[model samples]
Target: MASSMLKSAGEIQNLIFSQNQKLTHLARCGRIDEAVKLFESMPARNAVSWNCMISGLAKNGRVADARHLFDRMASKNLISWNTMIAGYSHNNRVLEASQLFDEMPKRDSYSWTLMISCYSRNGELERARWLFDSMPGVKTPVCYNAMIAGYAKNGMFQDAIVLLTEMPVSARNMVSWNSVLAGYTQNQEMVQGLKFFGEMQEKDVVSWNLMVEGFLQVGDLESAWSFFRATPCPNVASWVTMLNGFSKSGNIDEARRLFDEMPERNLVAWNAMISGYVQFLQIEEAYRLFGEMSERNSVTWTTMINGYIRIGKLEKARELLDSMPFKNVVAQTAMLTGYVQCMRMEEAVELFEKISTKDDFCWNAMISGYAHCGRMDKAVELYKRMPTKSLFSLNTIIAGHAQQGEMHKALEVFKQMRERNTVTWNSIISGLTQNGFYCDSIKHFVLLRNEGRKPDPCTYACGLAACAYLAALQVGKQLHLLLVKSGHVNDLFAGNALINMYARCGRISSAKQAFDEMASVDLISWNTLITGYALNGFGRETISLFKEMEVNGFRPDDITFVGVLSACSHAGLIDEGLKYFDSMSRDHSVERVAEHYACVVDLLGRAGRLEEAYKLVTEMPIKVNAGVWGALLGACRMHGNPDIAKFAAEKLFVIEPQKTSNYVLLSNVHADARRWEDVDRVRSLLKEIGIQKQPGCSWIDIKKKVCSFVSDDPMQPGATEVGFVLEMLCAHIRNTEIMPWSSLLDCG
Candidate 1:
């Protein structure tokens, strides 16, 4: 009988039109009215019947029609409500989703999970958690996974962990594990995530894929490659992970080769390739890949737009934004970032205002953009006006104040942070440390310790730097103990800072110990170690380390070069240092900046090649400053060459004529030549011009207190002792008939 009915072509056509698949096809092909007509003719509607109709209405944004169908369904089940709720939520109808949730007669796990997902998708994690907690009935792993993934996606990893702990043992499935592991991996906590994987007895491909991805995300490409080789059955995901890692790390050819060799390419695989191009700043390649995408999604558009923004191609970003067939928050965000990055703050602000529903990220982008553009006050204002704030928003604002030298504002923000993280404390400490407020930094380090907040490497580095600046040996020693206790002595930054502090405080042995303890070192690490050795006259070690840096594949930068050159200058390795300076541009690709030139001049001057050094100074690429000329003049004084000394002093005077040092240097050069009339004439000119010689002063920081000393100062606290020492020294010298050596000849 069924075959006979199918043989009737008209009846078969009618039955086909009534099928759910037929209606869905009609809607998918944009025949909404036909879909609705077909849905209306269904005599016995099932979940599919309602889903088809609801999807059609949702597709066309016919909210009232969807809601009408939802409420009128006498046999509506969990899928029906979930579909309607998700449709409403996705269409930016959160209030309707909420009301439907409130009015539903029966709520299942799917119902609660869907609502929570809606909140999470909209950046309302708090509401998502609220809905998650209020869910009735025994929860499924899907419900737990959805909420946990939401937290993880939102960068609330600690909260995600907390939620994971609350799930029943039965619900602690592989899906739940993947969420937290992926979150940790994204946050650069690979070790913690790997531990979770090890504890999972049922190790599946998903777990392995996530583990590999975690390594890849944090720039540990070598480790990820090792894992990929060890995997029993690697999927396309693993391949894509390697491709992304290589491309992001600046291996585009490798990424392209892997991409071409892929067995199959899904949308994700394609996006990875496009995104790789973006990461390498190869915008043209990204566009080429984008153009090759026969079909495109929001992710593809967003990636292309973001690439344009990153490369300072704002017009391209806007054109892409304008050409989009549909626009989402991600696309808008890319456009906003383009404007922000280009310092088009007004454009960013205008776009931000146009976003009717701003999320935490939207606010973060604007505030961070303002901060980056030096509009700190505007950043703070926008940050304050955000209805909801995240750690990112706060951090960006704090960094702005810190960078602008507004330490007080940074401190205030740190104090007011409701949930202070390691970065928050580090920022405030760094600000105080950088602004010559070492005492305050130390005080906060102690306060942070008392508050049970463990310091990270950055905190230790900043603290050690502060200690070096203040010569706080005791404080640095305590920090060293903390480093040992915390098992962070192997950290390169802390180790480097320790070497600096010990060297500055005259504990060269301790500095060497710290250097020896370092397990890994970079150029800055080598620079610090060498600078310490050089300043303490351990010239052999300094030169040895400079050689070691080259052998270790650490190409020296200007700072490293300067440190090595200074050591050479001090140790009389003038010829070797000059060779290094000459080789900087040819061998290391380092441009000969002013500091490098100054170091060369010092090296030559120290070697008593006064004429050659003076010629080098004249031919320098940059204008010679007073310091460089002053150094040359001082060297000439030692060599008893008053003619060159006078010429250098005059050059210095022309640079800053009002500086009394120039007058003093020139007059002394004349006095050295027995030109007393010239000295008298210079003195009279200074008196006539009302140019007073500023007193030379120095200060010592004692017990967290500052005490200043001036040359021949009469009002110092130690004046009595200083006066007595001078008289006794003079009397002893006269009694012994000491005579001047005239090494610094007054006449040439």
Candidate 2:
């Protein structure tokens, strides 16, 4: 009986060992479900079986399941604890990993190293360093490597180098040297990377590849080529890197030569070559290579499909996608994006609906498409249907609604967002500014600042624009100070906004100062400052700036000519105005628009040349608009020319019949000429049309508050005090003038 029992025990022990080995192999192969089934059905399991299952689960991104299994383990060992910590680390669950590490009954170098690497990978470098220093035993090379890599990854080159130097010679390996080199290359510090590369006594293919890639990234093609030739033994990756470099630098022929000369070609090399051709819009060459490939993967197919889509060959892209043996979300999304770009929303939606596994990028692309096409309803519908609303989608919805003039909807979305970024604030602020909600835009900007969100350049530009429109000089100045402190004052867009704000606030000198302070200038900058000077009645300065703009090689656009002509009109420089106007199309190729014509008419009218102004109005090539006729009528009233005024008034009535200003100007002109009948006729026509003259309104910014006044309104706060002060001023002026009061009247 004892011999029989011994035989059964031996068989059972062999079975358990065989089962553990099989379970480990299955887990390593990623057959997690099969491994789980096998584990459960095993007559008995040991620690190895349990640990293998847990490791496989965590590696496969089933961290929660692994943790559950771990908690239920009958007996936990050091390997079990270390595996669980590694699981949390792999999934970026740093808090859980730290907690579990603290609960460990025992720890080893592997356990400590896992925790340190976890922190390092998750950008918690300080915690990583602390853990490294606190490690109980001798630090292993792996631990030292983790810390050094962490420093280098975070762009702390000095720290990484110092740590590397402090490492014992036994611990210092090729990885330590390469980690620093990789850091320099990744950070685009190739100059330093090259110097470091020369100092290394040992170099590998990885080191060589890194140098080649670094040169390519910075567009130094010659250096990349030189490095490529010097590499003693270039691998497939090395060849592909050089090929991609040539392709990206617009040297397609060289890429082809290198591709053909490669000693061994892999699928990766072929794909790289095709991607390079596709990137440069060489679709035919990419397709030809695709045909030559004996085997192709999803990446190969997707690259070809995207190449077709990029060149607007949507049908070809669709055909390739359909022919794909297996479809992925990437190719589907690329096709959808192609449709969106072409405004073929129906097809895009058709494809979008067929995608069973939509990623965030795919969903965001669809939403952005609908939003860009002004289909907000569909965009909102799709956004609501998303399983996970990403920040990008939220920003897109807000921008779409704001662009469509649906501020109420935009605000509703904005209010619902629990988290916001700079883009979110910028969309709302700029949208409000664009739609004429200047005050509301400024309020949101202030709210953004109060929320402790750092505003970007776009935010400041929008805020400055609101200040310009409100003539809020104090607020503008405050924003200017903030910009300088933030070190974004030199940004082109912000600089232009500052110039405009100072100009509109009647600070012409300040506007000029802002203009001069700009480190670099675009055409918009020149146009802005020139228009500012013209509006401030600095006609000579405006013309001088325009001349300087041309001398600086900026061919004036239509806007530039408008400012020049307006300056001439305001300064009564008729000859210069006519000369510039003629040179517009001939010298600058700027087509004359109605605003240009209006400026010229105003120029002649202000000079008392009503006939010449009227002739220009009738003979202009383009169809005349209300502005032209209004300019003529204003000039007629000034010179008391009733006949021409009546003609201009009749045209204005036809073009802008609801405008009360035209009637008022015509009535004044008739009264000036003593044409009582005509004046009554104009007034009667205005009344018949049911048009009411809009009240003249002006506002002043006092102590950061905008105070508004309306014509003939006396109910405003401080109105009585303002009238009293004006009366006293008039009395004092009349009584105490050294010269006669008649001279004052003449001057006025």
For model 2, how does the per-residue alpha-carbon lDDT over 279-343 read when each residue is reduced to its tens digit? 98989989999999998876888899899989999999999999987666677888898999899
List, residue by residue over 255-351, the lDDT tens digit for candidate 1: 8998998888888889999999888899998899898888777788899999988888888888998897756566788789888877888898888
TM value for model 1: 0.68
Alpha-carbon TM-score of each model against the true structure: 0.68, 0.65
In order, what is each prediction's RMSD in angstroms?
11.2, 10.0
- State model 1's lDDT: 0.79
Residue 537 of model 2: what lDDT? Answer: 87
Colliding residue pairs in candidate 2? none
> Whole-model Cα lDDT per candidate?
0.79, 0.88
**Model 1 CA deviation exceeding 4 Å by range:** 1-172, 176-199, 214-223, 230-236, 248-251, 309-314, 328-370, 373-391, 412-419, 477-521, 640-748
State which candidate has the highest TM-score.
1
